[model samples]
Structures are given as structure tokens and as C-alpha cells.
Target chain A: METQDLTIDDCWNRIGIWSRGTEKCPSLADVIHCRNCPVFAETGRRLLRTPPHEGYRREWTRILADEKETKPLNLTSVFVFRTGSEWLGLPAAMIREIVPMGPIHSLPNISSDSLRGLVNIHGRLHICVSIGSVLGIAKRTRNGEERDPAYSAPARLVVAVQENRPVAFPVTETRGIVHFTPEMVKELPVTVSGTKAAYTTGILQLGNLDIGLLKDKPLFKALTKDLK
Target chain B: MLLLLFEIGSDRYALDARQIVEVVPLVRLKLIPNTPDHIAGLMNYRGAAIPVIDLCRLLTAVPCENSFSTRIIIVKHQVENSGEVSLALMANNVTETVQTSLEALPPSGTIMAETLYGGVSGPDASELIQWFDVKKIIPEKDFLFPAGE
Candidate 1:
């Protein structure tokens, strides 16, 4: 029979036959036989029907939908904080409060990063641990570009209730709270560098930026040795 | 017998595989102060706090240079009523795992009760493998203290 006489069902059947046992279906080039067939046009239009959402919306939904399947609702409350130029997040439930930076009694004969002293919060002494030191990142110094007036950011404490007691972490700046579903989180590859991997639970791609989510329990446990 | 081979500086050392619980990546350690020079710090493994001893420092008094290859080998040993205690040994590098016969292993003399040195022969020649007695390195007293405490 002539190709023009072929029906839409015939075109689809031909394509299915060609696709059998192959990784890919027959391309448009192979479907040249159906070019003049009215049924072919109808079949193609039906197969490629656009949903209510088009272009970027369709693309984004497809990506997000796949992510949703893999990462169901693992609700994570993320508290955004700054460590130098990078923006990072820790679990908000893990965090107890955000306190004003105060005099941190430095313990002698310890690593510079290990701020082993206590800080008074609400008339109670809570151990103040420097997040910079715990993550092995350099302490933000006043010299160099940090001295610029535009670069000046107030330091804040991220008080977290760990092991049934309150522990405070010194952060450079607080960027507010974020809630993440499991689908929004991605693990850090073993090769990714910087302070992200050590304390970061995963990275949440929000808009144009990648926000790091901190693994609080593991990080806190690693930093505080004798925490009762 | 099975052996876990790890590198410290240029030298390769082996430990009885039976004592090892698992091998994990080098993690962020909490540095404890007023401790021996060889003790690097403490690492948290599965909710329990464990001390990490720098194997290079404990053996040669010089600290092991930290790099990507650095790893913490978690080892388990039964101690009296404490049942099983887990300790972490930080090695400069982990090369591979090997199995050999005890008959082929040479005796270690004068290395003390805590240290064992064995010889393994390959087709070419023999290499010295030092079996570390992890239990003796960190006494119970030092294990309880946190860094800078």
C-alpha cells in the first residue's frame, strides 16, 4: 500500500515495531514514509500534546516531580547562617535560640579554634563553641577585606539544644529560616571541597544559589568530646 | 590470618583484621588539650565519643601529615567488665587489605607487650609489618578527658 493511504494506527504500529528491542524509537528521518499521511500528523500531535504548563514551567515541573519521588516529605527546618562569604544552614529544631554575641571566655592551652569557655545566656552558663573552629574553617579576622565598612556584619550565636542541654554556636550572620523537603536536598559528593562536606548534611538548590544544610548532631558530637 | 594494612609516613603497618570494626573516612575531630602529643583528638562514631590517636606520632613521635588519604580505623577490643570498647586509629594512608598464614609470619622480639612486629614474605622478598597494640596506647585515664579540658 502507498504511504499516503496509511492510517494513524498504521504509523504508530510502524514506529512501535521499529522501536522494539532498540534503545531509541525511530526518528523523524525514519518516519519520512508517513510524511504525506494525514494519520501520521494526527498521531504526532496527539503524542506531543502540551500540558497546561508549557516551556520552562513544564521542564521545571518534570524535574521537580522526579525529585519528589526520590525525596518524599522529610521536613527539615533549616536555619541560614553565614561562615565567611558562604551561606549555610543548620536544622532549626537542632537550634535552641539565636543570642547576641558576648564576651567568650577563651580557654588557655587549647587549639585556637576550640573556644572551650562558657557564655551566660538568660542567667545560665552555656558552653559557647565556635562553629568556625569546629568546621576547621579559619576564624574571621578583622584585618584585610574584613575591615571594610561594607563587609562588617554582626556576629550572632545559634543556640542549639544538644544531648538534652543547650549549646551555643557562634555564627557570623543569621540569614533567617528555611524549610526543605527531602526532594530539595542533595548529598555532597566525596570530592566536593571546602567546609561544606564536613558539617553539611546536603545542599539545597534554591533559585540561583546552593544553600548548605548542616548535619548538626554529627557535627556537634564531633566538636564536643565530653558532652554529658 | 587477615590483616589490615595502613601507611604511616613512608612505612606500612598491619593490624589484625579481627580487631577492626569498620574503616571510616577521616572526620572532623574535637581537639582535647593537656593530652599526650600523639593524641590527635576525639571523633564521634555512631553516637559514641571515641578518641583518635595519631598512629605516626605514637610510633615515631612525629605527627602524621593530614591529607585526603587520611582515615580513621575503628577497632574493637574487650576490656574486663566494660565489654567492648571502640577506639579510632588515625593513619596517614590506607593502602589495601591482605590475608596471610600465621606460619609465614615472623616473631616480634623486644617490641614490648603492647607492640607486635611481624614479617611477611612476598615473591620478591620480605617486608616488615608492625602490629600495633591499640589498647595499650591510650590508657583509660586519658580516654575520659576532652581536648582543652
Candidate 2:
């Protein structure tokens, strides 16, 4: 039978009969079940045959092309992460690496709230900052019990750039990189929380939550502020 | 003239539909700090950035909430010196568009010509509509940019 003649319903019916056996066979005799039925087996084989219908392929290609065209261009890769209950999108190009939260040696006499100290990764020391303090988001402590970063389950280091210098900050969780189109961007309202309004370039509507797009300038400035 | 009616708290207001470009869902607007409280900041309309104002805050001192009926009414606002520019007016509980004429609207009787444009009987005869004076919403200097810069 031609692939064009086979519909999705027919394939589903074949699958249903194969699983239900002779008693459930609608078209074939009860005794001559799906096992012996040439129609059921042939239909299944025909469905599996390579070189699918040209019309179907063209329809799918057209649909995908329309989707891409409508989504707008300038495909930006972003590393999405969570810190202090806020979801932030950082451009992947600006991020050096996402490393496990390692031993950060606290610097003495450092007065900045965000700038914690330094962490030695692969023999090189990187400046570590607390993203919560930089963004003004209160850290969630259980019953005033401070969870150690070294042993925390969601702690990870985000090595990012600030004024041409490398700055690493801690995040609650890393959601990995997601490719976003210009269409996904919504203007960040001036009425947004006072904490993230300064640096958030735009808002990306991802699912039900708005992911604040953090640019290199603000993120770096916040991380490095008062340290100089 | 066709009028776009919307509500802010308990009051119903209208803007000439001819000046309205489009009505859109209230989306997050990028805040411009140091600007007046009325200036809600910038919003991405089409591909360009346009200033948005909180209509409720400007007129009634009520901050517009993010609700199901909240919307941004894009309209052409004519500034004193500068030519007409597109601006988004954020308002809450947009009701519907109704056709009415300026002559049909009764004078609001308020002597404040700068703010109160006019008044009209709403679609539902029970409600009184206060026409919004778009021109007086923001002064030229305080429109988009802050007081000095």
C-alpha cells in the first residue's frame, strides 16, 4: 500500500490490535489475530518504510520555517541561573565557565558585601562575589542557620567578566545555556523590583516566570563595586 | 469620534481612538531611574524603545497594578516643542471602545483646562466618563528624559 494511503489513525489501530490480540481485532476474524493478519503487519511495515511522503516532509519544513521567521533573528545564547530566588539570564559569551563552588578563601579587611574573596581554580585565583548581596536579594537561611557554600547542594560558581576583568559569583542553581531569539525579549519595566531594575537589560518570558537578562556591565559593576 | 474607555480604580476614562495606535497587554517596562514617578520607563514597541507612563499614577495617584485587564494603550502624544511621538499609557481594567462625538460629550465644568479634557456619558448610562487630556500628562522636559538630562 502507498504511504500516502496510510493515515495516523490506521497506524494506531494496527498498534492497538497487536497489543490486544485476536479478541480485540476489529476488521480481522477473531481466530486470525494480528500475528497472522497480513494487513496489520504490512501496515506496520509500510509505516516504518524509509523515504517518507514528500508532502509530509514539505509541510513540516514549511511549519518550521514559519516558526523560525516569526521568532525574529539575532540568536543569542544565554546561561540561565537562579540566585536568591530570582532567575537571571547571562549571555554565554561573557561567561567563562560554570564550576563547582570550591573553597573560597575570605580576604581580610574587605568591606564590600558582594566581594567575598578568592578561589583557586586550576592554579589561578579568581575573585568570588556573592550574587545575592550584589543584586540585593536576601539570602535564604533556615532558622538563621547559614548553609556552608562548600557543602551546599545548589551552590555553583559563575565565572563572568567585569570591566575586562574576570569575576566569579555564586549561584543557587545553574539551568545551563538556552538559545533565545529576539522575540522572547520583553522590555524590563521600570516598575520592576528596585534590586534588579538597574542591570536587567530586558525580561525573557520563560514559562510562567520572567528571567531578567543581565548584561556584562551591570553584573560586573555590582560584583566589583566597593572592592576598588 | 470613537473613544477607547478604560478604568483606573473607580473612575472611567477615555482617549480619542484616532490617536490610539494599538492596545497591548501590560508587559514589563524597563525602568528609567531619576525620572518622575509618572514616567513608567521604556517599553519595546515593535523594534524601537518608547516611553511608557502610568496613567493611573499621573491622573489619580493610583499605581497601575498588573492584572488580567491591565493594558498599555499606545497613542501619539504631541509634545510642546517636539513633534508627535508615540507613547504607551499604562492603565488598568480597560473596558471597551465606544463611538461618541466631542459635541456629544458634555462639558466637565471643571475650570482646570490643562488636565480635564471633557466628560462623556458612558455606554452604560449610569457611568460618567472623564476624557483624559494626553497633552497635560507630562511636561516637555519631564516627558521622556529626566528634568535636566
Candidate 3:
């Protein structure tokens, strides 16, 4: 039979790895992968742009028959922790790491309760600040063995970096990383006081509890200030 | 120098990769009647028709097997009277290229095919590769139908 008689415009299937019982195209080595080859890319474009056949409309109609599935992806990730009795949440991106609560070395002459002292964590000194005092949350200890069972996950210093300076704050208990959708976040209620509401972006609802989503910028600004 | 390597029958051969315009997959061509056995057909290369020479048919009587590795190596070489011509050299198992200068292949070797064959790489080399001069196999007078005519 004449070679012309067996002509095919799509040479890729005939020579490419896609073909059955055919050796892979020699050009594959130079191009490395099929995606890198112009011929392969051109073939894909031609496939999409080719004149529609009888089944073209039928194939597309069948594919488009079903409704698209929508999955509720958790868009916001935050580290939920408790400062005094108030549950606060910070965007996971802002908090660099969390370490076990250590002895805070009080800086001489600086007598602010908020700026507790410097804590040595992994040979690095981080300014340990009491988040409860910084936010002016009243010192009401949940005393006893049954003291906040859910939030009894020991205290840890949340290390966050601002302008290269690392600051560490104590959290009563960390809820680890929580993924929440937009629907779970509610606007700050009017009853939220000035000093407390100033740093919070929104209130995140988790089960029966409400978590104040702290605004990273304003909180960092407040922490860095009154240091000098 | 880089050389596009291919096997003709059992023996491996090479062509200067520098002369190679593009290594295209084997495609169907417009057949030309009364042409020499080595002359495969005219390939439509971007609207312009280019003549393709089947190196296997030229060397051996058998046509190249319809395998994926078998490809048309398009090259533009200087012709005698005509300045430059784009011709396709079809070969089998044209998988990869080798990086070695022609100087590496010593002149001392057996003469398989005189005019078309260039310097043969000595047995001392890792793999014996005979350099096929795409210039010599230009089908000067034998090519009855010149493409673009």
C-alpha cells in the first residue's frame, strides 16, 4: 500500500507514547518530556480547535449534564488560644512557633505587668508579654482541678515576629490550628469594650464558644510600642 | 560537536546535529511517482513541500519500519547550483544525540559505502558511529523531482 494512503494529520499518536504497539517518539529525549515539545503542544491545540464531529456536541452535553460540586474549603487558618478567661485567635501566619512556658527574666527598671520580662527559649531571648495584661482582661484565675477542662492543655509561649524582633506571649491553652470558613466568622458585637475590640478583627464561632480573631497589624503595633 | 544518532539496520550512524533544522515525528507525505527508491516522498513542512530521502532504502533495499522511533530529520544544506535546500532525511531508531567532535573519529576504517559515507569512528571509540554526510547524499542528479517545482 502507498504510504500516502495511510496518512494521518495527528502524527503525535502515531509516533508519540500514546500509540499502541509503537515505540516512543525519538524526539522525546531532546525535549525530555512531552509537555516541553512544541509539536505536542500544537497537537493539543489542534485537538481542541479541530472541526466538531457528530459526537462532539453529544460528548460535551453529557459532560455538562451534572451540576458542579461545591466543597466547603476552610479559607482561614488561625491559632486559637486563651488569655485569662477570654478566648483569642491569631492568624497562624503571624505566630512563628510555640514553646513550653519558661522562667521570664525581669528586665531592670521596666515595671510594666504587660511587658513581663525576657524569656530564654532555645538560646534566643524573646520579650515575654502577658497577652491578658496587654488586653486588660481581668485577672480571674479558673482555679481548681476541674479548672477549664477543655482549655487545661498547659501554658505555652506563642512566639511572633514583628520587624525582625521576636516577641513571645503566654497562652493558657492552644487549640492548635483551626480551619474556619467565612460563614463561621461573625462581626464584632457592640458590647465588646474599646481596648479589647481594638485588636480583634472579628469573632469566630466554634461550637458554643466565641473566639476573638485578633488583627495582626494593630496588635503588633501595640506590643512594639511602650517598649522604649 | 553534537551529532544526531540513528541506527540503519544493525550499524549505528550519525549526522551533524548542527545541520538539523528540526527533528519531527514521521508523518504522511505526498508521494511522487517515477522517483528513485531512496526518495521517499515530499513532506508538507509549514506549507512548503520538502523532499525526504529514506536513508534505510538508500543503504539497504528494505523500507524503514513504521515505528515511533523512526523519524524525519529535517536539515537545510547548501546545494550545488541552488543556494540552500530544505531536505528531510528519514532514518530508524533516531532516539538521541552524542556530544563528540568529528576529530574523535579517526580516518582509518572500513569503507562500507563510498560517496555517501564520511569518516568512520574507529573501533577504539565506545560505540562505532559512521558519520553519514547529509551533503554527499543530496541526491544531486538522482532526485528526479525537486520540491517547490
Candidate 4:
């Protein structure tokens, strides 16, 4: 049988509140008007008669499988720091702890400027080195003004194991951990500053920052060479 | 045959594309002490250490300036009875590969030693390209291949 032609007014009046502002409530006057309404019941019956859409089912199944199969990108956690106006990334695993800055007593008659000297942290002495000096990165203020290397504040000491010995690098600033995929890191270009290029494994392009990923082994070897 | 076209300083040169194994992005090189200036350094390619030669420094006195188009061209060099060794050639601004006949190349008056095999003005209105002899760059007589050691 054919379903009744449902008028806009008939549907509107059946919902009681919609009829309140109108001049005439066509279907509202009768108490059993909507309960026995042929249009409303026929509409529900017709919806039940229709078959489910094939495209919709396929889309939903594919979406659910994708959701189940997809996993987050494999990322490596690196601790970022600023030294000599340049931002560098060090693998988090290499860092022992982010200890508060300590007074490094300079050794007399030592030639290397990068060697900041030994610092006592919690009854233990660790050799502190200026990474900025070693990498030949010029020390500058946040305003990019030239900062006297000797008077620069020792913000944090990044203690790392180099050749089984603990070596701490005094950094100007420490910007916690950042994650990056392997694809994000590109090999260090030959054109980079000679000192910086030696220690840098590759470069990662972060927003408004070029993070030079440092190689621990070479850096440590360079820093802690036997004094001849 | 296909020829790999590249620029070293201002001069354009072409190498047999078949000899080229791959083109890698220029990366930082580990300096080998007491080696020649033309020997750029050792680079890790596919976990194997290969010697890289700066073509500009070798061919011309000028050092190759690193640019966006600079590439490390890995080439296969055959040694006398020792087999083939993969060596990376530092090329500045490697442009593209073009089809050129060796017969079409005419003898030029340029008197540079064994390096230049033949010179050709492009079949079209393109720039002049000199055929670069790879064997001359790393001669088996002079170059001692560190056979996979």
C-alpha cells in the first residue's frame, strides 16, 4: 500500500510545541491525532523496509580496521639545549641527570678553553666542559649580544658517560625532551662550521629551530683526551 | 648512452651514467690525517667506509663550494686484478642525465692531461660538456684500493 502524503503543517502540528505560535493547530485539537497518525507510522514502516546502504557499510568497516591497525610513529626522545646561540639535541639516554649549576674551579696552566674544570655535585666531582667553546660557537645573550664567556651563568650541567668516565657539559639553557622520527634527521652538511660539524651526526628541522644532533662518542673523545 | 652531467666550478663535465652507482646528499666527512688535499675524507655509505675525492680540488686548484645541488656521486672503479672499489666523487651542482653519442664528440684544443677524453657542443643549443674519464680520476696505477678492509 502507498504511504500517506505527509504535509509540512501536519508534521509540524504533531509536535505540540511547534503549533503554539501558529494561528491554527491542525492536528493538535484531537487527543488521539498523533497516536493514530497514518503519516508518522507509515514513515517508520517505510524506513524499516529499505535495505542498508552497501557503500556506508564498506566505509565503516574500512575505517574501523584502519583505526585498529594504525600505530603511532616511532620517535626518538632527544634533550635539547642552547649553547653559543645554537640549539643542539642530545639523545636522552646519554644524559645521567640534569643537575643544578655548580662552581667549576678552573685548573691552572691548562690551555684548552673548552675545559671549564671540575665541579662538586653532591660530594662527587665531575669534570665540566664548555660545549660552546669546544664547538667554537660564540656565546651570545638572548638578545644576541656578545656575552663574556667567563662571566656567563652556568645554568645546568648535563652529566654524560664518556669512555666509562662521567663528563658534565655546562649549558646555558635546557629545553626538556622533544621527540622526532628518524626521517626528520638529515646528515650534517659538509659546509657547517668545522668544529660544530665534527660532533654533529645530522640535523633535524624543528619549527624555527635547527637542532644539530650530537654524536656522544666523538664529542667525548675530543673533550676528554689524555693531556700530553 | 646516458651521461651524468655535472658542474665543477664553472666548467661542465659528463661521466658515463652506467659507472655511477648512486647519488647521495653531501654529508660531513671524517678527515683522514696525512692524506692528500684532494682526498676529502672517509664517508660511511651503507655501513661501508668509502674514500671521497673532491673533484674540483683534484681537477682544478679551486675547492668545491658546497651548494644545495652538491651531491656525492658513488662510482665503481675497477682496479688491476684487485676487483672493483666504490668511491664517492664530490660533484658540485649535479644537474641531470642526457643521451649523447661518443662519436658525436669532436676533438677540442683543450690540452688538459688524461682527464678529458673528448669535448662536445650540445646536439641542440645546449652548453658545451666535456667527457670526464673516471679511470684518469682514480688510475689503477696510482690509486691503492683498500680492498674492503
- Chain B TM-score per candidate, please: 0.76, 0.79, 0.80, 0.80
Tens-digit lDDT track of model 4 for B67-132: 435667988877777778788898776756777655443444444333353444433344566777
Docking class of 3: incorrect
Candidate 4 or 3, higher TM-score = 3
TM-score of chain A of 2: 0.63
Question: Which ten-residue region of model 1 chain A has the weakest summed lDDT?
Answer: A45-54
Q: What is the TM-score of each candidate against the true structure?
A: 0.37, 0.40, 0.42, 0.41
First chain TM-score in every candidate? 0.57, 0.63, 0.63, 0.63
Q: State candidate 3's TM-score.
A: 0.42
Q: Candidate 3: misplaced stretches above 4 Å?
A: A1-74, A140-154, B1-149
Per-residue lDDT of A124 in model 3: 84
Give the CAPRI class of candidate 1: incorrect
- Tens-place lDDT digits, model 1, residues B47-125: 6567788888887777765443466787877666456667778886664677776644345444334234455543313
Per-residue lDDT over B106-127 for candidate 3, one digit per residue giving the tens place of the 0 to 100 score: 3433444332333344322555
Measured over the true interface residues after superposition, the C-alpha RMSD of each candidate is: 21.3, 19.1, 16.9, 25.9
Candidate 2 per-residue C-alpha lDDT over B1-149 given as tens digits, one digit per residue, 9 for 90 to 100: 78888877777777778889878765556788887798887766666667788878877787886553667788886665666778778887675787764545444434423334345542247566677666654555644442124
Order of all candidates by lDDT, from best down to worst? 3, 4, 2, 1
Candidate No. with top DockQ: 3
Residue ranges of candidate 4 with Cα displaced over 4 Å: A1-67, A139-151, A226-228, B1-149
Q: Per-residue lDDT for A156 in model 3? A: 89
CA lDDT, every model vs. true structure: 0.65, 0.70, 0.72, 0.71
